[model samples]
Target chain A: MQSGEDLNQDFRPETEAGGLTIRLDVFQGPLDLLLHLIKREEVDIWNIPIARITEQYLEYLEIMKELNINVAAEWLVMASTLIFIKSRMLLPREPAPENAEETEDDPRTELVYQLLEHQKFKNAAEMLFTREEVENAVWNRPPDEVLEDGGDVIAVTLFDLLRAFQEVVRRFESQRVMEVAQEEVTIEQKIEDIRKCFLVHDQLQFSSFFTAASSKRYIIVTFLALLELVRLREIWLFQQQVFEEIQVSRIKESA
Target chain B: MQAVMEAIIYVAEEPVKAEQFQEVFPEESPEAIRRALAELLESFNARPGGMWIREVAGGYRMTTRPEHHEQIRAYLKTRPGAKLSMAALETLAVIAYKQPVTLAEILAIRGKKSSSSLQTLLERKLVCILGRKEVVGRPILYGTSREFLIHFGLNSLADLPTLEEFAQMAGDQL
Candidate 1:
């Protein structure tokens, strides 16, 4: 049933113009926007009225342009795809042979499939959103409040540790002696020194390694040794919580 | 045995696995520990209390019941990270449903460049690189991480509602 003419009549530009005042960011992508358009139009997903939809989709892009929203490339690509499909569907199909075995190919087939697939995940995303909403309400004991300043559950990355190290270095530089002195600190020697320290204590603050250093070279060497130990899995470096001191724990054999 | 198991689970910093319980009680068989865990789970569920013993990421953890969420929300000063963006959620849904998927496959389904959303998911530790696909370009394959299951309070990936179920739910909503 080709309701193309009826849908074309139904596509009122003025009414639709006001309808699209909502933000462009509401759509996750082109498919999401198309699905929204299809749902709003109450059209069959399998047999989308492409001419009407392409017009509406372009209108949306135009609105986004007017609103000064950066329309992603994917939206433009889908626009062309809709135009191509609309043109293909408008063209008359060649007559098939009496004994033709192959099914008729519709240009919209690929798009319909993509839309259906995206819709499935969209629905899945909604389901996940609901679950997340419910789960967010249920608090785990000890709360696992990662955003807390001293919460030990939050993980710290190599970048955070490096930033902390930079701060330590900056402080040392600010309070350093004016005299330049060469230091004899090797990475291997520093690594051995760290290993010996771990043998006595289960854990040590990261800054503890640099406290005895007399020169910047010694601190740099110690940092390198720490990295080497980490690479070797001989020691573990981690913050107990966000914005807290990083602790270097010995990697016991059992762990 | 149930009380002992509950205490161990309560004291755990993270979800305590059945294997961990078995490791803790070396003399007990795996089946015995599993039975005790099942019993403990049932006992907690049977009571109309504030606490729920949930199985998340294949491990047990204690969490306040959702019914008391509004009260808890009012009492607590800080909250968990902000909810994920729609784009990030959609990308995560694709990766969760289709594990070992490449960026190309995800782009095909989403009909969008998912790199940013993928980056967000990776940063949140919800999605992880499974390894590279053995294709021409060897694009990185992605899958949901253990944190993903925990975030949704799921026992495992299998606990996620089926796509068919989602379709039905969507139908009802519409």
Candidate 2:
């Protein structure tokens, strides 16, 4: 429960007794993970808070290491790149050229450009995902899908996948911040709150618990806690209609 | 002749080419069938209806009006066909606009390795190998499948909006 920087500092390098196990959740890869982190931080992608972002990035790596998640080389290289940029940023700026019009280039500029360029494609990806979601609802003929797989496959669009992934990432971010701040309300506390609500009502609206959030961090953590409960199969997310409010329902076994 | 052509187009599960209409009814000339198709399209446009015939992938098919999307969606819950992930979609988009492109071409645009995404798209039958790129590595060239046209509800590759159009749409949204 250390700060991101502290987590990196405290963790031993050789404690990787656990074998690498990365669940290939198709929606979340290296860039997607970085984008999620950047979005949760709510900073300009063009002007990243490199030092803090790098700390958080490495902290994620630390957790992944502990869990033995297979860290891709791209992620490691990006980490190195961030560190390289940080180092370059630390160095004193070079004096301007004789032309007097040119300015010394910031080391972060290249990475920032890459992120922005990546963002454009990501935006385009989102557009196509949305289009698929839209056009998918109406079909001239039924698509040739092997639907008899029996409840294993979730036909979630990238949009839903990304949204769900985003929520989890945001929740993870909040949880880290809470750990740093030493908050009174833990995810376990939120789980308890959810259980109490389920006792009172058959179903709970996701938004009803918080009409207006005083702290974005706590709300996100609560949502994350809710997801953890869902992961444990204690509850499930459902909606009566597309674009309707999501509701929480307790599993029959849990009752 | 127009009625016969409508019947033929209606019966087709996939898009029906004008040549297909001629081939099916060899007694009718391709020119006559083309005229019938034009007239049928004009009639559909003139009338207010849920269905409209549109050309896609070098063939014509009837599709529901976008305005009735919500109503149709309500009536047919869980019919929202197959989905492509953002990674796959981005890979597909790159291939879509810059078709007959190699895997490298797609990777260059997206700035990520698209091996898995491309495989997923191929499995979904949304994209297919057009041919070999004829370059040194000769990486397989990819293009949108006919199924992709049906899936995206596009009349043709030409139906895809230009990047500027997308920018304008984004501008409007903002």
Instruction: Give the count of colliding residue pairs in each prediction.
Output: 1, 1
What would the DockQ be for model 2? Answer: 0.16
Q: How many backbone clashes does candidate 2 have?
A: 1
Locate the minimum summed-lDDT window of 10 residues in model 1 chain B.
B165-174
How high a TM-score does candidate 2 get? Answer: 0.59
lDDT of 1 by residue, B1-174 (tens): 788888878876578999888878899999999998998899888999999899999999998899997788778765755899888889999999989899999998888899989988887789989999887988999999999998988989898888888665545432
DockQ for each model: 0.55, 0.16
Model 1: pairs clashing at backbone N, Cα or C within 3 Å: A152-A240
Candidate 2 segments exceeding 4 Å error:
A1-27, A98-104, A141-255, B22-35, B45-50, B64-79, B108-111, B164-174
Chain B TM-score of candidate number 1: 0.92
| Segments in model 1 whose C-alpha atoms lie over 4 Å from true places | A1-23, A97-103, A143-255, B167-174
Question: Who wins the lDDT comparison?
Answer: 1
Q: List, in the given order, the native-contact fraction of each candidate.
A: 0.66, 0.33
For the second chain of model 2, what is the TM-score against the true structure's chain B?
A: 0.82
Candidate 2 local lDDT, A19-91, one digit each (tens): 5344435324455556556766778765678898888788777776775766777678778988998888788
Task: Please state the Cα-based DockQ of model 1 relative to the true two-chain complex.
Answer: 0.55
A1-255: candidate 1 lDDT, tens digit per residue = 012333234223232364543343456678867777787788877678899989988987886776555677888999999999999988997776778643357788788777777778888987788899898888776634344544544345768778878977987888887756665879999999999998899878888888876777888999999999998989877776677888888877741
